[model samples]
Target: MNSPTMHLPHDDHDCGWYGALPSPAPAKRLSGQQQADYAVIGAGFAGLAAARRLAEQKPGARIVLIDAQRVGYGASGRNSGFVIDLPHKMALEHPDPAHKQRLLGLNRAAIDQLQGLVQQHQIDCQWSHAGKYQGAVGPRGLAYLEHFERLMTELGEPFRSVEGDELANVIGTRHYSRAVYTPGCYLMQPAALVRGLADSLPKNVELLEQSPILGLKRDSKGQWLLQGSDGQVRTPSLLLGTSIFTQEFGYLRSRLLPVMTFASWTRPLSQAEMVAIGIQPDWGLTPADHAGTTVRMTQDNRLIIRNTYKHVPRYGKSVNEATREEIRAGHRKALLARYPQLAGVPFTHTWGGVYAISRNFTNFFGELETGVYATACDNGVGAAWGTISGALLADLAVGAESRHLQDIQAVTGMPSRNPPEPLLGLGVRTRIRMAAWNSRSEL
Candidate 1:
């Protein structure tokens, strides 16, 4: 391990997100004064990647990485584990065909980088080499996926285009009218990977768990000292990979909306159950019928289903019982709607986690005061992107520039001040209402 930073407060007592994944080893508590060249906040994918890269780049550079709770306790460990190469708003309204072409090119490269990292790290989180369905449940969804696939292939990526009953054969569902298959992506055990990455660190690096920085100060020497109730750490540079928790960095309380994305897992479906569901290919499923609802199967055979636009305070009574029921019902509807035969499966476990929502509903990054940087607003895709962001942001912290630095910087002007309580409340209510209206479930 590298140098250890102080710990923040503990998160609620939910560890099920790890989903029987092997537990990462415990990190030591912060004690006394520690000095480092780099201090990374939040030990999820972003922080971990930063820590590892810093170790590789500046060997023997004192680095202290801190987590508010245990590492991966946040969105990183709780993700649905979809390794996507697509950008947030990858299909922006940009009119320039060349810009669109270039974006497609970058997406291809991003996917390659993501897959390679999984392989290079020897991460054992059930890597599936098969293609996934970007199928549409209706005409519009199908058209969107088809257009996306067309552009991808046009940009030199591989995709299999299909429609009608043929689409059902590829996905395990009759719900979709059309679909395109791409072999490059996968369905993974997300929390397992997060834990694995944390455990694989060399002894030279130190991970401090349960360390939350309560405040900060600037020394006369121009360095920043992050202070916690238990201890204080002095580092000249720092990285904020806290996701929506970036509010801790200041001015992000409104800019980054913390949307809850809840997931439910059924008892591992028996062979009969799986067959009844028409899930032949084991490829991860995305709604070709629509753009939202992300559903997939874990390697262990459990169905992992999630829907977005849910929220509650960081810890507020399990999103209320009514909301929980809706998510659960929605998943069952998804299962039955897709595989009409598998209509009544029962869920064994139900839980939810938060996703950061920037104004554009994608990832955005920029400075939060001098010397402190925030790399958050992960929209919904936080697995590989969070890891890559952490790596690139670490480079930025060390004064090394990245080709992506400009594109992301352009989006993260100043963190928007959060709207008023009433307006923010209205936004949340609107999202819930819109989701309920579209879903097959009774709102």
Candidate 2:
């Protein structure tokens, strides 16, 4: 019988954040035969955390973490860089106070753990506790923000309301009529952070990049035989943190939805341009309407505009040039609306990143089968959720127990099943279009 093979998508555009960083060291691809006590596929936040935790738990065990591309070249590194401490859009759907509290704790735990790693390794990812701004431009958005404020109050989370001149002074834009500022969110250079974590993994954990798993099978002893392009790994236990691609591994097929989002970054602004804008040096803003644009001013004075979502059931390996131009044009329009003073400025980089979201906004975290564990579909909050889920997954694999693990289970049980193919695509596209129309003013 032919061996079961997996096909992975190839990304077309380079992430602006990754492109801004210095060139990464050459990748160490998997070659020759290898045996590992544990194997992890995907080197994003979740996989990196899983491998690190497993290595910490089993000092003598060999843990191999593999990625199809470089460590900082995937969805984890392509995110908007917000380590959110509180639930945003999810809170609206799941108003259960207990569930929200548990989620908050889990997210905060992720932040604390990340802070320790950054400090210990001195990772220069511009780790900032500078908080986040949720802004609204239209009456619909204002109503949503008001609802969010109520939820925050019910949760006893402190937040400040800013409007008009106050909001403009802070974010350097008067486009938003009202905003809610919460100090719990942390902002950073996502690419830098992921690369730092990969580089500082434990001594026992082996990180293999550019080593896509091409095939899979079981050995005589029922161990996992993972075949790569140049080599293969046989291991007793396997952990999958491949997100939406977990389907390519023959699991989570219709249970996950791959939504592609696009982002564009401007080259670092000249000092004169910076002075002309007269905005805060560094801050991040997410729209009150979930579908609206996300804006950020980097510490280095570059501007980032992120928005647009499309349901790509087949998964987006590479965005075609036409689609790239369309998305960039949308971003350009948003930037001009918000920071018209910088219309002459051009975007240095534009890229698309795909993240998996479930129908019910829950994550898939559990043992898939005997000797195989998996975590996928982080529901758009991948940074914190992915990190925490990865660590907890490692604990489960090692037969260790903790309250955090239980918390993760209590909150995110499993991804609810999704509608099959054509229907799923049609539904998602319709909803996205409706949302875009509603948030047109915000965009």
Candidate 3:
């Protein structure tokens, strides 16, 4: 087949968290011909982890890390910035008990990896171990939280339940009638963290940005050739932590679903507004209802509200103009519902990021071809999953063995196949709409 076309968003809507930070170092765009012992495509959390792990293992091996845009400009940077350790609702309900433990172990490992990097490098991305709140708005939401409490109890995890006046004191919003405070999630500025990860990569790894891979094929010399717009990379081994974009390469195409989640962050609150809202310091909260908004008060005092999921099907693509505006408008409404005191607080940034989810809610891992390996489809937990998966894929690439590697390899399988085109697309869109309606109160 000919080289596939790239459809990544041109705007990415202006991410507030990313925008407020200092500009990243100059990008090193790939040009001419380059060669490496290993090439890991996509420089998000996963790719960064994988590249770092490979560099550590191989010492002086030539490793090339490539991204179409700047290292953190994609979903990794655009996320709501929660490094969640607990299993999401779907993972909590996973049929296999062993699977649940394996998932939790991997997630915690990812968090540990990130924490260690931050401490060792003193990379200041406002990393906080303040945990998170899951707030419920009504009976359905309360029921969900109750189930969550039972799940945690079964797993022997500790959590604090708060409601009424206490919940309001914690989050500065009395909108939620009930909440479960889980202490394992860390909140940070995602863009800064990703940039730091790229900056701190081992000496053997070379980062190439603004270099979109058009195609990849095995050459006559038994090397994989990655054709990009301005250059090419040939490597003996490849790891694709490209997340949702893995579908474009004819890998995981049948089973992966590309969906975009939108977020908006208000400008830093004024002293008067802060006093009016009354939430002290910084905090983060996820919704008890699956479709509810994710809210965060930044270290800088800005409030970020993320809600609305849109199924766009194509990876690296942007939602349409109308859809983008609709999501942003919905964000405003969600914020107003919680903090009407902050009404008219102008949102400094609004953006959308794409994440891939498999039909069965499991991630794609392990080798796809003789020398090509992949890890993608993080479902909703991108930060932790991507990081750990990236590291594991690197180990897998070099024939390294560990319990982490074994746990990852044990779950290797293709994502369940999606129905043909329009049917699949329609189904995904319909499901999102239904979810939104069901979670309207939380939104």
TM-score of each: 0.85, 0.97, 0.97
CA displacement after TM-score superposition, residue 349 of candidate 2 (Å): 0.5
Q: Model 3, range 108-216, lDDT digits (tens) per residue?
A: 9999999999999888899999899998999989999999999988887889999888888767888888889999999999999999999899999999998888888
Q: lDDT (0-100) at residue 366 of candidate 2?
A: 90
Over 4 Å off in model 3, which ranges?
Answer: 1-6, 9-11, 315-318
Give the Å shift of residue 118 in candidate 2.
Answer: 0.5
lDDT of 3: 0.87
CA-only RMSD, every prediction: 4.4, 1.6, 1.4
lDDT ranking from best candidate downward: 2, 3, 1
Clashes of each: 22, 1, 0
lDDT of 1: 0.65
Whichever of 2 and 3 has more lDDT, that candidate is 2
